[model samples]
Target: MPTYEFFCHRCSKPFEVTCSIAEYGRKIKAVKCTKCGSSKVVRRISAFQVQTAKKS
Candidate 1:
């Protein structure tokens, strides 16, 4: 699963969704503003920050 960032033009709010890449891509096209219920949504560059252990 990956985290995705979305910008809502209708409500001028930013929201995040975590799902599989395929799920994200499919649902993203139909995403709407939770506040305004508008289809004016844009996908922004989402970050997946993680800290990993170094190999010994």
Candidate 2:
């Protein structure tokens, strides 16, 4: 499973959920707002960091 970020349009809050890649590809259509219980949620582009080894 992978973590995905979501934004609730009703409460303007962001939340995360863990699901399979297939499920993620299917798209989230009925996700409820974790804070306000609203179904108007949209997927958000999450940022991640990549670390590299230092040069010798």
Candidate 1's residue-wise lDDT over 1-56, tens digit each? 76677789888899876778768658878877777888888877733332222322
lDDT of 2: 0.73
Candidate 2: misplaced stretches above 4 Å? 25-27, 48-56
Every candidate's CA RMSD: 5.2, 5.7
lDDT score at residue 20, model 1, on the 0-100 scale: 84
| Model 1, runs deviating above 4 Å | 47-56
**lDDT tens digits by residue: candidate 2, 1-56:** 67778899988889987778778655566667778888888887644411222322
lDDT against the true structure, each candidate:
0.73, 0.73
Per-prediction TM-score: 0.64, 0.63
Cα-based RMSD of candidate 1: 5.2
